[model samples]
Target: MLKKVLIANRGEIACRIVRTGHRLGVATVAVYSDADRDALHVRLAGEAVHIGPSPAVESYLRSDRIIDAALRSGADAIHPGYGFLSENPDFAGAVAAAGLRFIGPPATAIRAMGLKDAAKALMEKAGVPVVPGYHGADQDPDFLLGEAGRIGFPVLVKARAGGGGKGMRRVETAAAFKEALASARREALAAFGDASCLIEKYIAHPRHIEIQVFGDDHGNVVHLFERDCSAQRRHQKVIEEAPAPGMPEAMRLAMGEAAVKAAQAIGYSGAGTIEFIADASEGLKADRFWFMEMNTRLQVEHPVTEAITGVDLVEWQLRVASGEPLPKRQEELSIDGWAFEARLYAEDAERGFLPATGMLAHLDLPDDLARVDSGVRAGDRISPYYDPMIAKIITHGPDRTAALSRLSDALAQVRAAGVTTNAAFLRRLTIQPDFAEGRPDTGLIDRHLTELTMVHAAPPEVAALAALSFSGTLAARKTNDPWALLSGFRLWSGASDFILLEHRGQPLPVSFLSKGEGNYRVLLEGRDVDLRISSSPDAFRVEVDGRTSTLHEVHDGKATTVFRDGESWHFTLADPLAGEDEAAAAGDRIVAPIPGLVKLLHVAPGAAVSRGEALAVMEAMKMELALPAPRDGRIAEVLVSQGEQVLEGAVLLTLEVEDG
Candidate 1:
């Protein structure tokens, strides 16, 4: 085995690699940018080195700096954990030329499958089934348009060099083809520095099924079953599971064999995934699947494979990189049970799933029933320079139904504040009728978005509890003094104290008259509730309407947050003595929701725009967000121009409401 391994990445994947390396008695080294100086991965590694500034181009993608750090730290091998430089064949070759082992596929294999166009050609020659598309190198707009017509409408114009859905767009008709092509190319050039693209026939109702393949230096390769990643948004995966639901023995064998063939065609070594887009309009069958693309490194969803097969993929990467043979043959590997992985991201699901950034005030995750892979703690900040994924919640059970149930329960038990999250949305998605029946497809989220994204108001009882916790009334009950016990208590006259709070832009008053003995009568919005409250180390038990429930609360002075049954609410304390000011009217101004660079200005000052028209485009966290005009009006002031970096709530422009 290698003596020491340097992880050339950051975040949860980096932390994951360090854990496995340490477990195998191999010292680990971590490289970080300026933003990740105090990151969890840096703290977990045996030795750490600062590479460059926070921008990924200056730090994480700097192969020279990463190579130097590895050599300086005496690392014998380098593990590029999926992203940044993981699939860059040039970087792999650079590391190998520096006398350091690259813990991934050989540079030739990476080059063979680096570009989608070239890789599909290679797969077609190797007799691996590929999707019908245009992979030719003619970049003229007219030529591409003709090809689109040939392939049929609803074609996907994808960047040949892109992943993570950055430079991809789906066109539904010929009328939208020109605009979609220009947009896709613009994003492609900005993201990958390559304006070239490929056109593919869009598969309706497709399921994203991928096979995990491993290879060793001894020219041996094997497949570790497959993962069903059909649940997706914005062309990115959300929930993934192993032993694809309703997968038959014959179909699994066919996909597994084709995956091994794709890997062997490139002489692939180490860990890689062969992703296939299956036409599930019918059902999963051997002939319905076609090759999509091959990821030439470890995957983010590898944990689900680990939970089901009892195999550590990182361990296999290390062993294979150290000149070892394949750990097990194809016949020896078999699935044990079922597993699920839900990606918890710091993104608001209600607001178009825009990424969020802030300091984590409190984070409480469930244990015992699930395994959490996280690179952040309670106090860490979610920076704007990186991906906003907080953690991967993994659950295992004896069957698919049991595993899905455990995953639903585990997501509910997670409590976090200070940054908006998709946890609530994830909880709703898990219980959807189609999802429960294992009938998820790539269009599942988009098709049922209205029902899945329903927003619920916080109950008045929850706000009352927050008020008690914030005012120290809940903690004072443990005191010995008689006066403290009766702090908020009133006599027979029935006097009540009003606690003012603001939630969802509305003022809520909670009136309470304590009866002592941890009992109180609370009135909120004209509704009365009789409750008894008690506190334990982990949660507060409240009995209301003859029903008792346990809840967790976190307060950060600015916002008091309460979590109950997989849902959360934030209430900001309102000043009772101060006079309230008139709220600002809507559609007056447009502001940025997150810090990002203005990529384009679609409207100039004094330019008239219709309601819901795209006014500007902002790039944040590597995703482009279109700032739409709130109403039919003219742009009053253009506060920002293209290429300017703006902070959250920084007004990009204002609109002068058009007279009716």
Candidate 2:
């Protein structure tokens, strides 16, 4: 086994590698950029090295800096954890040249499968089925347009270099092809440093399934079965599971065999995934799947595979890199149970899944009900410099129904505060009819987006709890002190109090009259609610209208959040002295929704634009967002130039004021 290894990554994957390295008695070294100086991964490793600045281009993506860090730390091997330079063939070669072991496949194999277009062509030559598309090298726009027409409408334009839904667009007609192509090319260049793309026939009602395969230097390879990732949004996988639901035995066997063949064809070693896109319009069939691409490194969803097979994929990678033979033969591997993994991101599902940045004031994930893999702790900030993934929740059981039930229960138990998250959205997906019935496609989320993203209004009880917290009633109850109670005394009746709170931009006035010990009559929005409330330091026992429940509440000075059954309702204390600013609320200025670089400016000063017309593009968190005109208007002035970085709410341009 390698004595010392350097993790050439950050975030959860880097922290994940460090744990395994420690368990195996191997010393680990972690490299971090300026933004991650105090990150959890840096504190977990035995040795640490500073790389560069916050941006990935000047730090994690720099092969020379990573190699130097590994050498300086005296690490015998370097583990490229999933992203960053994990799949870069040149980086792999560089590590080997520095006399350090690269804990991955040979550079030749990575080079062979690095580009989607070339990988598809190679798969075809190896007799593995591939999707029909134009994998040619012609860069002319007219030529690509002709190819898309020949392939038929509803074609997919995908970046040839990288994955993760970046630089990918589905064009439904020839009229939209040029714009989509341009957008895809620009995003592709920004992400992968390669602007080339390939056209593929979009498989309507498709299901994404990938096989986890491992190989050793001894020319032995074995498959760990399949993971179904059909639950997606914006062409990105949202939920993943092992031993695909509704997978036929024969079909599984065929896919497993094809996956092994793809690995053998490239002389590959270490951990890799063979992704396939299946036409599930007719249900899963043995002959309906085609090779999509090969990920030449560990995948983000490898835990589900590990849960079912009872194997540690990272350990396997380490052993194989240390010149060991395969741990188990193909026949020796078997699936033990069903597993599901839901990605919890720091994103607002109600706001078109926009990435959010904030300090995690309170973070709690259920450990007994499921496995929670995370790198950030309470007080950690979710910045815009890296992926917005907060954690991945994985659950396993003896059957699909049981496993899915556990997932739902686990999601209900999650509690996060101080940032918008998709925990509620993920829980909704778990119960989505088609998904719950084991019939999910890539378009499942889009088809049910309206219902899935619908923000549930906080109930009267929830609002009551927030009011109690805001008025210090809950805190006073915990102390059992008469003087601590802030309820104003009335000579004739009982102590009464009135507080104002805001929920979803609407002000709510709550009034309550204290009856006696732990009892009150609360009025909110003209509805009266009788409540008996008692509190401990961590939780409150509230009986509202004959229903009893326990709830957790947190007040961070500005807002109060009440959590119950994994769902949360946040309410801010409304100030009576503050008045609404109509000017700021009006749609006269275009502002950046999040901190990002201005990638393009579609309109200039005095340009007349229609409502919903794209005016500018902002790139942040590795995704491009096109800002549209809020109404029919003419541009008055452009405040920022392309390539300039702006903070959230920074005004980019203004619309001319028109007289009515």
Candidate 3:
């Protein structure tokens, strides 16, 4: 067993690795950038080293800095905890050169599977089914266009060098091919430093099924079954589950064999996942699955595999790095139950799922059957310097239905504060009728986006709880006239207390009354709501019917109060009547919604435009959002230039409202 293992990454994965290392009596070392000094993973490690600055390119991706940190910490081996440098063959080679064991495959295997174009060709030669496409190296635009014509319309243009759908585009017609190809190539170059792309036939209503293959240095490998990652947004995996729902036995065996063979063809070892995109229009069939790509490191969704197989893949990685043989044989490995993993992102799902950032004023999660794998705690800031994935919520049970039920309950109980999150959206997805019935495909979210993302506003009763949670503020203000904040029936009647908050940037005022001491009644819009308070000075629990929400108060001798109730939360004003005219106007302008590079500017000074015309492009959180003209008007002035860094809501261009 390895005594000390250095985790070559940061965030929740680092914390996750430390836990398993501790369980096996192995010391864990953590490396962090300046941006992550206060991160949860750094505090959890047995030893720590600061690698470099905040930017990942200069820090986490620095192989030399990581190797030096490992040597200084006296770590016997290194675990590339997904992303960062996990699949970099040169980094693997350098680790071996520095006399440190890399807890992954040999450099040769990484090189073989590093490029998609080459990997697909290799899989084809190995007799594994590959999607029909043009993998040739001709970079002529017209040549590729002709290839697309031969492959039929609706071909997928994918970056040869990267994954995550970053440089991928789906073309439906020849007229859209050239523009898509150029855009895809540009994005591919920006993200992967390689503009080369491969065209593949697009599968309609595809189901993404991936096989988890584990190999050892002893030339042995076995499959840990498959995961169904059909639910997604913008081609990114959102919800993943093990032992794919409605999987045919014949298809499972065939996919497993193909995946294992692909791994063997590359002389792969350690933990790697082989992804296959299947045509689900006909349901999962043994012959319909085609090779997508191979991930050469531990995956973010690895927990689902562990949940069903009852195996600790991290421990297996450690054992294999120490020159051990396969721990288990193919026949010995089997799935026991169903498992689901829902990715909780700090994003506004209602607003194109734009990544959100703010301090986690309060965070809470239940631990019944759901397991939370996260890096941030309450009070931590969700920064734009990295990915906005807050956590992964995993649940397991005897079957898929049970796991899904567990997922829904757990998502509802998660209270995150200080930022907008997708908690409510995730909850809705779990309880979706089609999702509950195992009828989801990759296009499910897109097909029913309106239904899937209809934001679940706080219930009327929750609004009541929101009122009571902030009612304490009124008590402090009306100290002189205690009756001012107090509500009761003329000793038996009730008095209504008004509360104000901003939901989705719209000002909404709510009213609630004190039924009695500590108990309250709330009216939202025009509906009456009930609240049951069960709290002490430090915290309060408000229960309504069957749903319960916890509220934590923060008093800084001010008028603005934050009402934190799980990830689904908002701020409240201790005095709503006084904040009616605090809006910024004139010289003050609109700001960017989130931190990102300014991608495009649509107007200039003296330019006339109508309401809803494209204004500018602000690229944040990897997605581009168009800022539209707020009102029909002529441009008074352009406030910021393209490529300027502006804070959230900073005006890019100001418009002069036109005269009637």
Candidate 4:
């Protein structure tokens, strides 16, 4: 085994590698950029090296810096953990040239499968099933348009060099083809530095299934079954599970064999995944699946595979890299159970799932109920310089129903604040009819988007809890002083204390007359209710109108958040003395919703645009968002230029005022 290894990545994947390395008695070194100086991964490693600034281009993506850090730390091997330079063939070559072992596949294999267009061609030559598409090198827009027409409408324009849905778009018609192509190319170039693309026939009702394959340097390869990742949003995976639901035994065998063939064709080594796009409209069939692409390194959803197979993939990677033979033969491997993983992201589902950044004032996950893989702690900040994924919640059981039930319960128990999240959305998806019934497609979320992203108002009980926390009633319960208790008492009559709280811009007035002894009569919005409240170190017990329940609350000095039954509601103490400010109405200015670089400007000064017209495009968190005109108006002035980095709420342009 390698004595010392350097992790060439950050976040949860890096921290995950460190734990395994320690368990195996291998010293681990961590490299971090400026943004991750005090990150959890840096604090977990045996040695740490400072790479560069916050941006990935100047740090994690720099092969020279990573190689230097590995050599300087005396690490015998470097583990590229899933992202960054993990799939970069040049980086693999550089690591080997620096005399450090690359804990991944050979450079030759990575090169052979690095680009989707070229990889598809190679898979065809190897007799592996491939999707029908135009994989040629023709870059002419007119020619590509003709090809898309020939391939039929509803084709996918995908970046040739990278994955992760960075540079991918689905064109439904010829009229929308050119714009989608331009957007895909721009995103592809920005993300992978390669704008070249390939057109593929989009599977209308597709299910993303990938087989986990491992190979040793001694020409031995074996498959670890498969993972289903059909639950997606914006072309990115949201949930993943091992042993795809509704997978036929025959189809599974065929896919597993084809995956092994693809890996053997490239002389691959270490951990890799053979991703296939299945046309599930007609159920799972042997000939209905096609090879989509190959991920030449560990995947983000590898935990699900480990849970069911009872195998440590990272350990296998290290052993194979150390010149060991296959861990087990084909007959020796078998699935033990069902496993499910849900990606919990710091993003607002109500805002089109835009990535959010803020301090994690409070964070908690039910580790006892499930496996929680996270890189951030309470007080950690979610920066805009990288991905906004907070953690991954994984659960396993003897059967799919049992495992999925556990997953639902675990997601419901999550508690977080100070940043918007998709916890509620994920829980809703778990119970969604099609998903719960084991019939899921790539378009599942899209088909039920309205129900999935709907933000329901907080229940009256939740609002009452928030009000109690903000009123100091819950805090005062911890003390023994009678005078400190907020019991509205007087010499001759019972006095009522009134407090105002705001939720989602609406003010709620709450009045309470404490009845003493943990009992009170509360009035909120003209509805009267009796409450008895108590607290322990970890939770609060409240009785609302004679029904008892336990709840959790997090106070961040500025806002009070209440968590109940897998949903959260945030409230702020309203300043009754403050007056409302007179400000400009909406659409007066076009401001960025998040901090990002301006990718394009569709309109200049004095240009007229109607409501919902695309005015500008901003790139952030590896995704592009098109800014739309809020109303029919003419541009008065353009404040920012293309390629300029701007903060959230930065005005990009202004609309001229209407003539009275």
State the C-alpha lDDT per candidate.
0.89, 0.91, 0.82, 0.90
The prediction achieving the highest lDDT against the true structure is: 2
Q: Which pairs clash in model 4?
A: none
Q: Which ten residues in a row are the worst by lDDT in model 2?
A: 577-586
Ranking by lDDT: 2, 4, 1, 3
* Alpha-carbon shift of residue 540 in model 1 (angstroms): 2.1
Q: How large is the C-alpha RMSD of every model relative to the true structure?
A: 2.6, 2.5, 4.1, 2.6
Q: What is the per-residue lDDT of model 3 for residues 390-508, given as tens digits with 9 covering 90 to 100? A: 88999999999888888988887776666777887888788778888998799888888897677557666545545554556334432456665443335555666676765555556
Q: Local error of candidate 4 at 223, Å?
A: 0.6
Model 4 lDDT at residue 333:
95
Tell how far residue 299 is off in model 3, in angstroms: 0.6
For model 1, residues 1-660, the per-residue Cα lDDT tens digits are 999999999999999999999899999999999989999999999999999998898999999999999999999999999889999999999999999999999999999998999999999988899999999899898889999999998999999997889779999998898899999999889888998999999998799999999999888989999999999987889999998988888999999999999999999999999999999888888888999999999999999999989999999999999998988898888899899999999988877888998888888776766999999999999988889999999999999999999999999998889988889899899999999899989999988997777767777568888888777786676567777766655556654677788886678888887766677788888889889988887688889888888888887767888999888888898766654232233466889989878988998888988989998998877678898888887889999979898889899899885465
Query: Which parts of model 2 have CA positions greater than 4 angstroms off?
Result: 138-154, 171-195, 485-487, 580-587, 601-615, 629-641, 654-660
Would you give me the overall lDDT of model 3?
Answer: 0.82
Assess candidate 3 and give its TM-score to the true structure.
0.88
